[model samples]
Target: MEGEEVGIRHQTDGGQKTTYGATGSRPSSGDERTAQIAGTSDSAPVAATDDGTSGLKSAQGVPAGPSTSYSDAVGLSSRRKKAIFLCLALNSTFVMICIAVLLPFFPQQAAKKDPSDSGDVQGASAIGFIFSITPLAQFFGALFVGRIIPKTGPKMVLMIGGVLVAGVISLFGFVNDIDDWADFLVICYALRFVQGIAGAMNITATFAVLVGLFPNNVSLVAGTIRAFNGVGFAAGPVMAGALYDAGGFTLPFLVHGGIMFAGTIWLFFTLPGDAEVGTGKKGNKMFKDSFTIPWSFVWCMTMFICGTTIGMLDPNLSPFLEDEFGLSATEIGLVYLVFAGTVAASAPVTGYLGDRYINPNKLQPPSMLVLCLGLVLLGPWAETNLTSKLWRSIISLVLVSIGFSSGITLATPGILNAMHKAGYEDTLELHSNLGGTVTALWAAGLTIGPTVGTTVVSAIGFPKTNAIFSIPVLCVATLGLAVGAAYALKDLYYRQRTGTYSLERQRLLPSKDQSTAM
Candidate 1:
């Protein structure tokens, strides 16, 4: 390292290395730390970098600064890269489609099961409960992934979860056949719960693998996967609508189950096998770091909002469209194309901008505002004749879709950068922990969004519920904008005047202890 100081290093071989970044030499043990080992506490941090030959490239001359691309410092063979991408990308596409297949029809069926029938509140609340149950299971399942990933490794967990989820998807087909409301409700809830566990497992594992494989290009990786995920979102409705017309309620789920099973088998053949890869006695810390990490809350809020962008619509939106527009299930599913299609296109751009130009955090607030605008129009609460216009609904869906996908795509990469700045090492364990934590928060949002959206819609109707929800999102967007602007200015000052910047301060300047430390 020349003409710079290193703030953090994640080398493969574990060797004593020269430092770069803010100071020409390393800081005292008290002033700095690296990534937390799996079970380790704040003590016993790993310092220095490894040789270039391992999966990660050597960082011998590179500086850990703002301008540096993390992916550029990491390396992978072409074959391995292909295997990782194909296995994970296909998995994401199929999983999202499977998760989405029910959105167009299930709420309508649950609405019918409503015993009170006293308007929409009671039914909406019950239906919301049914819809929310799956993500609720996923919230816990994320925690479960943290504990198991080290012992069984992510590969086994991904496989098991995939197979199990496929079974749940297959079994859900039987629910519509039950005539009894109690049995139908019970079966639906049970299947959703199981599905949530499977989903959490699959998603968490997938994220861990991506993080491990592309530690440097996290933003790009997240963006690419999200693009595929958006495609699944776009396709799910079309597939469901067509399948329902072909075989009624049973066919969509059965087809989804088959697709999921096939994807799982592909993964089993593709992903690498795992040995005992636990960090140490502190292996539990990898799971616990979700709480201990200083900026975990920041990522949590963004991740939650990302999830709600999709979730808030799931419990009630389809039925609202049906009642307001006189649309059939198939038609309702087609309407979803507006939302999912926009997501498919915009998510990748959000990621690219975050990586190539502005900070990922800066991208979020604007997208949130876009979402707020969409929600307002979705309700058509403008108090005019156009309030119920179908075109207004389409435009609103598109905006909401953009916000949803961008929010998710930005959060993962942003957290990785933030963690690196906060003095956490960019290691596989660290990435795995982050994946689990973020997934947990995302699950929480998905659970809460539907439950709250339904309950509120019951009270004020969907239009009013959407209108009111927009208020909070608007507030958050405003705050994020102010904060993001301040940081952007700070970075500009550091880069232009001082000539270089890392997370903490300008690397062109030296720390007070540089004399003694060097």
Candidate 2:
């Protein structure tokens, strides 16, 4: 141990020689003097000499990497970041899977339990409402979760949500009569609402930590996580179907609920401390005072229009498949599995492109253009009653769904970059736990889309209603493309006019991790 001393020597730019010294003893030895010398030799520690390392840890207690001050909470290594991603990805998968697994059982259970129910009760519309309501609750819940998460903490929120989902789902198993069913439904719906709120919070917290841990690769990480989201979507209904057939209605819900419950326990026990707290008053102030639309109203309006379009399309797809092809509930669930499945599949590739090749803002137009084509294909199919026509339409709609999902996936990165370019970081807290706010905005559009689409379809019939709805999609696509093009032209014009894009100097330094890697 006496011969293990390590001293590092370097020459300063000032033409002076300097020697950096550290004992070779591992920080774990609890030697205070050795840690002080080694830790301060590199990055500045977060706490000053007074507050930091109160115990005077030895070199053996110090880590070989950066100091504690430099390390993020949970000590996110690149490896741990990957772990976080996997956990979050599993979280996404589990949530969607839980929702999907119940679809197959619901119809058969409904029919067997109540033969006196009307066609409306048997209709996919009721299921659609059940499906739509949770997301609808999520939309509203996102607006407030930013304030709530910090107060309650992510672990608590996840735990509560998981318990609620489990309890409500278990309750679904015990209801013996139709008279008490309304109460069961209400409890389930309320729990779903709570789940939405917690989901939004968890997503934001997890993403924020990842961003901090891997700032440069945020988009790539997001894309990768989204790819897993597809896996969940694809796997959910299949598992649900298998379980429902083999185990019965009660089993699937209980099993799915149990998985969620397990994930909640994992978070409570394993989630790193000091990763992030919550979106606080400062975040609220930043949003209120600094958040702005980079392209005037263009981006906001585009999201609003697209959100509605997709929301309507998502909810109605089940019914559409049923009415068009005379498909059963199981068949309709398969269709949803395909549609969402496609979206999940394409997210990673599109996200990769958005992060690496294309400028983020530039991603909007191409995605939107493709989505418009997909919507157009859906129009004629809306009126077709032939089973073959329905299958063909399903194929075409899958194509469209892929395009639209790609567009939706691309929008987040694009908006983020646009905001960054416009210097809205301080105000929006865009890189922090403000993901819920962004999600909320998108959800608002979705909420409007379904309400309007449903109302219009009810009034005018699906075919005519779709034809009218297509107009907004096209217009929004056109406007979004135009705005993106304008930004490109403006950047070009500025380069031509001046040697530099702007006279402003760069103040922010790259992070130490990135800097050292470079």
Candidate 3:
């Protein structure tokens, strides 16, 4: 199926202002016109004259209008941004809840349906396949979906993906009803693949819309979405266990799927249409452009490493806990809750730092260092059989959770800012394509993590496997720090050689209008 991306933004050239994407642009007939887009509560439209200057006055004489092909209206209010944030947050929460609900029961579910008397290795492999397939499908979905978004629009893609996800997950509740083990495995794999595709489509569209609506708050919006996703992750397993105990496997799927379905329906009725941009020919070129962007590559690599670290635990953690501590499914779910809860609590704070206090580029290396440290600790922590493994596991999970959440929460905003600094136009198509690329790399990492983690653990055991995985994360962190230091030194050297800074130079530089209009 073809998936599309969409977003909304206003662009002005002199006195003429145009809103792009699903909201069609039109030239203003009057000398002054006010345009209002959805997701804002501002009653006063941001007024602009035909000469492309803001009507509002600044302290420093008439400040130069924001220099770009398009810029967010100075008058665009915060109320609208908050409204859009809530929608994205709820959507994120629902999506994660669906994913996490089944995690705690994977081993038991696989064994219950396996006809053959396979050993633990075989069971672990089976679990890996089950968990990894979704991300694998998502990888492909994200790679190709950007090409489709301009044609269909992001709203359609979001709604369609949401519906498909709900339907497929609901079907999961029926997997146990099948008689043959082969048939059951087939059904499970098929559902997961479809679910992954749906997830990719939904996420890509949602982010595209958010960027379109509120470009200034990219980090804040990203953080809020992740925060809710963490909340869903924290809540899903607990709710699943409770429901499973109350009814069976059927109840959890039905309940989770129903909640998602309801949210999807609400989004359909309430969410504003994303403004579609560019023809298919222009969009094709934009897709090509996405690959050419240098920061896109950096962001993708960062995503891949982060994803691998997070996903490494998926297949192995439950089985490892069960073997070492003899924990039940509920207990395993509770262990996961620690990680998810930490993420839920920390993401907004990390996001705020990225958006306001810290430069995202500067934040990345330290975040990765924390992740590496957590991974290193896992080996020794797991071997601490002398004390309660539970406490050790909790401590390890908390450390890892903070690192993982900080890394992910910072990534989108950092990359987006980098792209902006590099002189890329903040267009809907570009944002959508970049979003796809990031998601694709992340999915690829998630796919690799489990497949590799399971194989390594099966061969060498968890401690050695974990210690080995920490190497790549450490390598990535070191590279990021080196690059950041190089950039800082370059900037410093330029400042010392020149009497004035580069930013001051650019600001003092005369505009094209200064010569042409004169």
In model 1, which runs have C-alpha deviations exceeding 4 angstroms?
Answer: 1-76, 104-128, 175-184, 244-252, 280-296, 319-331, 382-388, 482-518
Cα error, candidate 2, residue 169 (Å): 3.5
Model 1 lDDT tens row, 362-413:
6768878888888888957556445577888888888887877777888887
Report the lDDT tens digits of candidate 2 across residue range 302-368. 5566677777776566676677678897777677767777777777777777665665456666666
Evaluate all candidate structures by whole-model CA lDDT and list the values in order.
0.68, 0.56, 0.68
Sorting all predicted structures by TM-score, with the top scorer first, yields: 3, 1, 2
Show the lowest summed lDDT stretch of 10 residues, model 3: 31-40
What is the lDDT for 402 in model 3? 85
Q: What is the Å distance of residue 423 in model 3 from its true position?
A: 1.9
TM-score for candidate 1, residues paired by index: 0.75
Q: C-alpha displacement of 324 in model 2, angstroms?
A: 3.9
For residues 1-518, write the lDDT of model 3, one tens digit per residue: 01332222333322222234324343243311323222222322334433433332122223223322222422233675566567667877888788878865755877876666666566556655776789999999986676566556677888888898889989999888887877877888899999999889987877777776666567777777888878877777778888988998898898888988898888886665544354333445544544455444455567788898777787788888888789997788788877888888888888877765566777788887888777766645345453436676678778888888887777777666565555445555556676776778789989888777877898988766777887887877777787677666766878899855565234323346643653
